[model samples]
Target: MALYGLGMAKGLLLTFSYLFRKPFTTQYPEKRLTMSPRFRGNTFVWYEERCTGCASCAKACPLGIIRIVTHPRPRADVGNDYNVDVFDIDTGRCMFCALCVEACPYDALHMGGEFERASYRREDLVITLDQLRALPKKPQTQFRPHLETAGYKGDTELDEHDAGRWSL
Candidate 1:
């Protein structure tokens, strides 16, 4: 009987404890939480101007999610116009390891920080080139801040201030 009473007392104490404690839940939609700088989100970017139609990202993807279709540029003197006609990423199979981004020698790809990628159907998750291109570009300075902070030697093409120039 004493043991039963003790158990009941403990349970009641736990119930009462919450009454005095602050609520942990936030009113979402009204409030938001900031993720870490390194947080990888579900936005895909294409530096269409920079891509050399290397097809490295497509080859590196283990799930075969990346597809590239290249065509010759209008002028014979100008190089091949590597347009991503059918760049489809099946979010259903994507591990988000950022291998595709790393494999891109031209820095044409990078991880974006927008994580709310819920979809009603599996087919909806498969992002098309038009959808990927529609996404707003993240500031170049936002990516790999550590490298910039350390003053690493590399392409000085993309700096913090020059981030907002690109559109589409």
Candidate 2:
């Protein structure tokens, strides 16, 4: 009957061993862990220069949280020939789906690694064009699937127009 308590003793010994070991959890705000390449953070990054205002990202969003407003550019020589006026994303309602990034024909949108997006007001959760543009730019390897499979190595001379189109 005394041997029946052996399991509990073993369990307690295992717990004590782990208690003496160095903790793996980092003290947030002071020490931060490097986010994985696949981490889906709350922040959204948009490259204004690369965006064509095609609204493909918006269409791909099932929640319709992404909103974009665009107007024709005055100069024909300019790339895309569209001036993005309003680009807003309601992060509060967002599901953190990477569909927007995958659907962007221009490869303009990317998932950011910033996870600390707590806000006091509901209105603060809405990310604007300026905010989106301010997010850190991640290499195509992070969001572009085709590029990821290609081992992120290839000709750097890809034309801007051709980069937007994704083909099967």
The candidate scoring highest on TM-score is 2
Candidate 1 is scored at a TM of: 0.69
* Candidate lDDT (C-alpha), each: 0.66, 0.73
Which candidate ranks first by lDDT, i.e. highest?
2
- The CA lDDT at 19 in model 2 is 79
Off by over 4 Å in 2: 74-80, 139-142, 145-168
- For every candidate in turn, the CA RMSD to the true structure comes to 5.9, 4.9
Error of 1 at 87 (Å): 1.5
lDDT of 1 by residue, 83-161 (tens): 5566777877788888887777666676666667898888888878888667666523334444446553222334333
Name model 1 segments beyond 4 Å from true: 1-18, 74-81, 139-168
Residue 122 error, candidate 2, Å? 1.7
* Per-model TM-score versus the true fold: 0.69, 0.79
